[model samples]
Target chain A: MKVVLHIWRQSRPSTSQDFGQDGKMVRYELDDVSADMSFLEMLDILNERLTAKGEEPVAFDHDCREGICGTCSLMINGRPHGPERGTTACQLHMRSFQDGSEIWIEPWRAKSFPVLRDLVVDRGAFDRVVQAGAFISVNTGAAVDANAMPVPKADADKAFDAATCIGCGACVAACKNASAMLFAGAKVSHFLHLPQGQAERDRRVLNLVETMDKEGFGNCTNQYECEAACPKEIPVRVIADMNREYNRARIKS
Target chain B: MNWMLDYWRSSIGGKVTMAITGLLLFGFLVGHLAGNLLLLSGPEAMNEYAAFLKSKGALLWVVRCGLLAVFVLHVITGIRLARENRNARPIAYARPDTIQASLASRSMVFTGLSTLVFVVYHLLHFTVGVTNPEHFTMETSAGGHNVYGMVTASFSVVGIALAYVAFQVVLFFHLAHGVQSLAHTLGLHHERFTPMIKTASVGVAALITGGNIFLVLSVLLGIVEVQS
Candidate 1:
């Protein structure tokens, strides 16, 4: 099948006036794309073609093509991870596209997630936020039995749901304001639902939320765009939970 | 106090502040609209309601001052959040699009600022009576302030009535986003209940805007009029 690709291209030299300091969309036509090929595999084929033609290949991020790793990020046709909902770019197949369709692929857009290369962004800000407080502090001694600390079924389910978040920055990419509340909120709620996370609960919310703000991410306006674009289908309710935790933490502190 | 200041400085804090103040302002609107609806009950009820409010004296001033403080906070925090939001995305998408963001949600800042301008004009026209003093200087036979006469005289003019209706449309946009935002900001959400909340947000906005527009149209269409 034939697919016309308009992919963002940026180099370290940054000499192109059309692409700006970061880069701009460069067109590539691939007539050999197969329906069975995953989105990353399609990119691989494009790169293989570019290599044979002695041209620079389009750059993108993908670790595991299995979709569990949030390393793959792309704004395909203005959507995070293409049109298919609850799936990553690595999981999106060429079958989702028509034979004669034009595909526009760009990097995740956010101030904190600057475009490092073509379709690749530096998501170090998410790392910094996680480093701030997405964990529980515990003295490592003898290993405790997981079942010993029985958690409520509802709470455990909610925690596991939140734990599915892979820190892809799609929430920021999807948000009109580039808000990371959905991402940060999921992190906060993942811990808050556990008894083991109770000791540092207040500190966790405060630090994660503050770090997210300091990273220049915008506040949530309840638009639910993040949820819609989330590959994990993380609910906006996590954000509300984060708000609740932050308020409770504020009052307690 | 220092902690309070710190709380207000956080993004979540700004959100909570906006929610609380926005809800307060919404409450004020509900009351204001209810009072305005008294116009339909004839001149005596509308004017008497105005006089009753005025009769509160110090209590009325207290409420006004509190409302003023809330309004200032809401506007200030809103502007700050919006500026931060703009900065968070220095570079925009080449072909930006939304999967689910409503038109009202996206245009919140514009709608809010427009409503702010409309509010100032509204106060000048009615509350302070500075914009149209001739229409403002009406009185009832019972020696109470003639709010019915003022409202009727103001709305009788097609242009003035249309202007009020225009502002009501802007206010509708603001309220549409705001009412639901308040619930979310306050950390209130349930999977079963959120859909209802979203619907209620629009419903409440429609009711408020509809009531206010209805009053203007009522006067304009001569359903309600100033007593000769």
Candidate 2:
């Protein structure tokens, strides 16, 4: 298959404009590429070609190309990880592309996630939000019995769902306001649903949410863009639960 | 508690304030609509009702002040949130195909601002009696202050009636998104009942806007009489 990649090229955030002056979409046409290649593998092929020509290889982030690491981030065309739902960019196959088609590939577009180079962004803001207090303070003791705490099936299931978030920042990229509510909400709900996380429930929600806001993420307006764009399919209702916890924290304090 | 002030200053706090204040305003809208519905019952009933409300004196002023505070808070929070949202996305997407956000959700700020403008114009036209002096008279019958005459006369003007109807349309957009968003902001949503909540939001918005528009049009159509 022949694919023409119209990819965004930015030098770096330090010397380049964040609002469009220094960025340009450079096109590279690759012929006889295998349709069986993963999107990341296709990018690798392009990088190989660019390196053979002694041109600088297009830089993109990809740690675990299997999609668990959440490092393979790309806004293919206009979507967070291309048009397919429940799939990250690394999992997206080249078979989805039509022959001789032009695919627009760009980095996550948000003020908070600044472009580091071509198709890569610094997503440390998410790490900072989690660092605020999305965890439980459990004393390091002997491993407790696995079935010690009687957990409801519903709650356990919800906690697992909330726990599936990979910190991909796709929700922020998909949101019109670049809100991080989905990510923050998932972190809050994950802990709020567990008995192990019950001690500092209110503090967890408040601090994490406050940190998210301090990091310049936008407020959730119930747009559902985050949910739709989430590769894990985490619901936006988690955000509502986050609100409930934050309000409860305020009232109780 | 300063905790509240601090919470209210956060992102989620702004949203919570908007949710709570919007619901308060929604209550006021329903009550005001019910009171205006009395106009269809003729001048004696409407005037008596208006007098009853006015007779509360101190209680009425307290309620008015509280309502004003709620209204102002809702507006200020909404404006601040909208501004922050705009700032979050400094670089616009070249091709953003919004699959999830409704047109109403995105246009909330515009609708809310339009409604705010209409509220000011409304206070001036009817409450302050400054927009149309001839129409807004204080000298009608019934021991009360001619409330029924004032309402009918102001709504009878074609231009005023059209403007009211237009604002009513904007109010519909505001309430439709505002009500459903309250569910999320207040943490009252469930996956099983989301569609139902959205439907009810639209239904409530329509009832309020349609009911008020019906009253304005009835006066314009001469379906109701302006008691002398």
- Predicted model with the maximum TM-score: 1
Q: Scoring each candidate complex against the real one, what DockQ results?
A: 0.71, 0.68
lDDT of 2 at B138: 59
Candidate 1, after superposition: displacement of residue A197 in Å? 0.8
User: Model 1: per-residue lDDT, tens digit, A68-135?
Assistant: 98999999999999999999999999999999899999888878787767888888899999999998
Q: Candidate 2 at residue A116, lDDT?
A: 83
RMSD of each: 2.3, 2.4
lDDT by residue for model 1 (B84-201), tens: 9988887778777789999889889999999788889989999999998987887788666788888899899899999999989989989998999899999999989989999999
- What is the C-alpha lDDT profile of model 2 across B147-182, one tens digit per residue? 888888888878989999999998998899999999
Off by over 4 Å in 2: A1-4, A14-21, A27-35, A97-102, A139-143, B142-144, B226-228
- How does residue B189 of candidate 1 score in lDDT? 90
Per-model TM-score (chain A alone): 0.95, 0.96
Local lDDT at A45 for model 1: 92
- Where is the poorest 10-residue window by lDDT in model 2 chain A? A12-21
TM-score of every model? 0.96, 0.93
Q: What TM-score does structure 2 among the candidates reach?
A: 0.93
lDDT of 1 at A146: 73
